[model samples]
Target chain A: MAATSFQRILVALDGSDCSFRALDFACHIAKQYPGCTLVLVHVIDQRALETARMVHLQPMVEEIVRTLHAAGESLLAEAEAVPKRHQVSATTHLEQGIIAQRLLACAKEQGCDLIVIGSHGRTGLQRVLLGSVAHAVAQLAPEMVLIVREGAAASAGA
Target chain B: MLERILVPIDGSPPAAKATTLAIEVATRFKAEVRLVFVVDDSIHVLAEPSYVQPDYTFFADKMREEGEQVLAAAAKRFKDAGVKVTTQLRNGYVPAEIGASVKEFKTTLILMGTHGRTGWDRLVLGSVAQGVLATTDVPILLVRP
Candidate 1:
C-alpha cells in the first residue's frame, strides 16, 4: 500500500465566491499536513479576451488585456489572505490563458499531488452551456481533484 | 469540522487508491465514515434486448452478493485503519444513489476514485465521478489511477 501524502496542493481561484470557498477548504486541509505547500493561481479566461478583441478596436483590445492581467493579479493577491488566516503560507500566480488547462499545467510543474478547485454553484442551466473550469479540471487532471461546492465546506452553515 | 465522510466503492484500482486516501483523511480528521456500494440500475435495462429475459431474481440476487462483497472488502480496510465505519448498500443509478447517501448521511466530504481511462474503465468509475459532480453540490475528493 502506498502511503499517500498531500504534500503539495494547487488551489485554482477565479475570484468567484465559489473559488474563495475552495480556498477556504484548501487552507483547512493544508493546515493538517505539516510542510504542505499551497500554490494559489487565477487564470484570465482566454475566451473572454478573444471576445474583447473581436468586439473592439486594437487600442481597446490592448487596454482590455492589460486590465484583465491586472485584475488577475489582484485576485490572486486577495486570495492570499484566506490561507494566511489559516496560518498556511501560499505562493500566488497569475497567468492568462485557458483556466483549467493552465491550472493543471501548473500543478504538473509544481509536482503537486492534489488540485483543489471550486465549481460554480449554479449547476443546472449553467452546465448546459458547458465549460465549467472546476469540472474541466476534474476531468483532465491526473492529480487528485477536489471539487468544492457551496455549503459543502465544514465551515459552511445551512 | 470534517464531521462525516462518504466513500463510494466500485472495487477498481482507483477505488482502492481512493479508499486509502479516505482512510488517511478520516483518521486525521477523526470523522465518521460511510462506505457505500451502489449497484447501478442499468443492469435491469441491459437485461432487455435479449431473446430470453434473464431471470430477474438471478440478477437481483447476484448483484446483491456482489455489492455486499465490495462493501465488506472496503469496510475491512477502513476497520484495519482503526477508523470506525458503517456500510451501506443501495440499488439505483451509481451517481444518484451516491447523492442520496450524501444527503441522508449529511456527508461533509466525499472521497471517490476516477479511472479516467478508456472504454470499460471510464464507464465503471470515470463517468460516475462526473455524474456525481453534476448531481450533488458536495465537495468530492477524486483520486485518479
Candidate 2:
C-alpha cells in the first residue's frame, strides 16, 4: 500500500476563529503531501437574509447577493493568507444555498479527497445541536472529514 | 510461535487487501502467521436460494464444507509468498470465535475485511472484526473493500 496521500482538501471558512484554525490545520496537512490541492469554500446561506427582507422592504434579494459576494471574498482572502505561510497550492469558491448542502456539493465538484472544517462556526452552540456544518459534512460527505476543535492545534503545539 | 499474523479465508477482495497488509506488516515485523477457518453458522443463510425448501441444516453443513475449502485455498497464497502459515477450523460467530482464538493463541493483532455483510449473514455472522474490536482492546485493523 502507498503512503496515505491527501491529494485534495476542502476547507470551509466562515470568518470565525474556529474556521481560521481549521484553515491553518488544512495548510499544515497539505504541506505533507507532494501535490495536494486545497479548496476554500465560503457558503452564503441565503436563508438568513429572509428576515431582513421584511424589515427593509426594498429589493433585499439584490442586497443579499451583494452581501454574500463581499463575505465570500473576505473569507477567501483570509483562507489565502494561511497557505502563503506554508508551501501549498489552493483554490477558492463562493457557494449559495443550505450551508451543509452547498459545502458538500463543493467538495464533490472539486473532487476533494478530504475535508477539514471547524466543529462549530460562528455559533459555538454545544447543546442540542451535536454537530455544526463540519459534523454534517463528515457524516454526509463520501470523503474523510477532519473536524478541528478550538485550541486543538495550539495545544498540540504546546 | 507467531511473530507473524494469519488471516482466515473469505473470498472478498477487500478482506484480502487487509490480509495483504497484514502480510506486509508481519514481514516487516518478522512475525509468522497461522490462517484459521471458522465454520461460521451463517454459511447456511448465504447458501440458500430465496425460494428453496425451508430446512437449511443440510445445506448449511454443505456450505460450511465449502467455507473450509475457501480457507484452505486462501492459505496457499501465504505459503506461496514464502510466508509461514497454519490453518484451523471452528464453529460459531466468526468475530467472537476469532477473538477467543486470538487470545488463546496469543496472536498479536487481528486483521479483517469489512465486507459489511448483513441480514442472516450478519445475524448468524457477527462482524468478527467488530466483535474483536469491541471485546479485546487488542489492535484490530479493518480493511474496507
Candidate 3:
C-alpha cells in the first residue's frame, strides 16, 4: 500500500489550553508529511450569542457578539504560532455558527482531509469522555476526525 | 511521533478501510502495529453459565474462529506493507478489552473506523470507537470509511 498522506488538516481551536495542545498534534502531523498544510479555524458560537440576546437587550447582545468575535480572532492568532514554530504553512479562519457544525463546515470548505480538535475545550465538564463539541464532530464530520487528548503527544514520544 | 499504533478489526468494510490506513501510516512512520480482534462475548456475559446451560459456548467458539480469520487477514496486510505487526485474539467485552490492550501495548495512536450507524441506530448501538475514545488517553484517528 502506498503511503496515505494527510494533505490538509483543519484544526479547531477554542482559545483553551487543550485546544492549543490539539494544535500541537496538527503541527506534528504537518511536519511529518512534506507539503502538508494546516487550516486553523476558531468559531464564535452563535448559540452563545443567542443566549445573550435572550437574556439581554439588543444593544448588549451586539456588544457581546462583538467581544466574542474579537476573542475568537485573538485565539486564532495565538494558535497560528504553533504552525509557525514548526515552519508549516497554514491558513486561518474565524467563523460564527454552532461550534461543531462550523468546524465540520470549515473542514469541508477547506477540503481538509483530516479534522483535529482537542478532546475537550473551555467550559467542558470534567471527566467527560468528550466535550460536547468533540462528540458531535467525531460523529458528524465529513472527513477524518482526530480527537486529540491533552498530553497524548508527550506520552507517545516517551 | 506515533510509536505504537493500535488497530481493532471486526471484518467490516470500514474495518478493512481502517486497516488499510493503518498499514499505510505504520509503513510511513515506522510505527509498530498491534492488530486485535475481540470476540465480543456479550452473550456469555449476559447469560451466565449456571443459569440455563445454553449452547452459547458453540457460538463463542465460532466467533473466536471468525475473529482469528479476520485477525490473520489484517495482520497479513500489515506485514505485506513491510510494517512491524502483532496480532491478538481476545475474548471479552470489546471496548473494555481494547482499552486494556491499549495499556498493555503502550499504544500511542488508535486508528479505527467509525462504526457506521447514523441517527437513532447509532445512538442506540453506541459505537466502539466512541467507547475506546472515552476510555483511553491516546490520540484517536477515527475514520468514517
Best by TM-score: 3
Docking class of 1: medium
The alpha-carbon lDDT assigned to residue B113 of candidate 3 equals 82
lDDT of 3 at A22: 82
- Regions more than 4 Å wrong, model 3: A2-4, A150-158, B45-54, B116-126
**Residue by residue across A1-158, what tens digits does model 3's lDDT show?**
54445999999988877788788878987887888899999888888788877876768987888888888788788888889989999999999999999998889988999999998888668587888999899878868888888656566666
User: Where does model 2 exceed 4 Å of error?
Assistant: A54-58, A128-130, A153-158, B1-145
lDDT tens digits, residue span B41-131, model 3: 7768535778666656777888889988989888888888789999998878788999988889999889888773222335522378777
Q: Once model 2 is optimally superposed onto the true structure by TM-score, how far is the C-alpha of residue B17 displaced, in angstroms?
A: 9.3
Interface RMSD of each: 3.9, 10.4, 2.8
Question: Candidate 3 chain B: worst 10 consecutive residues by lDDT?
Answer: B116-125
lDDT winner: 3
TM-score-wise, the better of 1 and 3 is: 3
> What are the runs in model 1 whose C-alpha is more than 4 Å off?
A1-4, A121-131, A151-156, B45-56, B116-125
Under the 3 Å rule for N, CA and C atoms, how many clashes does model 3 have? Answer: 0
In angstroms, the error of model 2 at B84 is: 23
Computed on alpha carbons, the lDDT of every model, listed in order, comes to 0.79, 0.65, 0.83
Model 1 lDDT per residue over A38-102, tens place: 99988877877788778776678778888988987888878988888888989988887877789
lDDT of 2 by residue, A115-140 (tens): 87775687647542224675466446
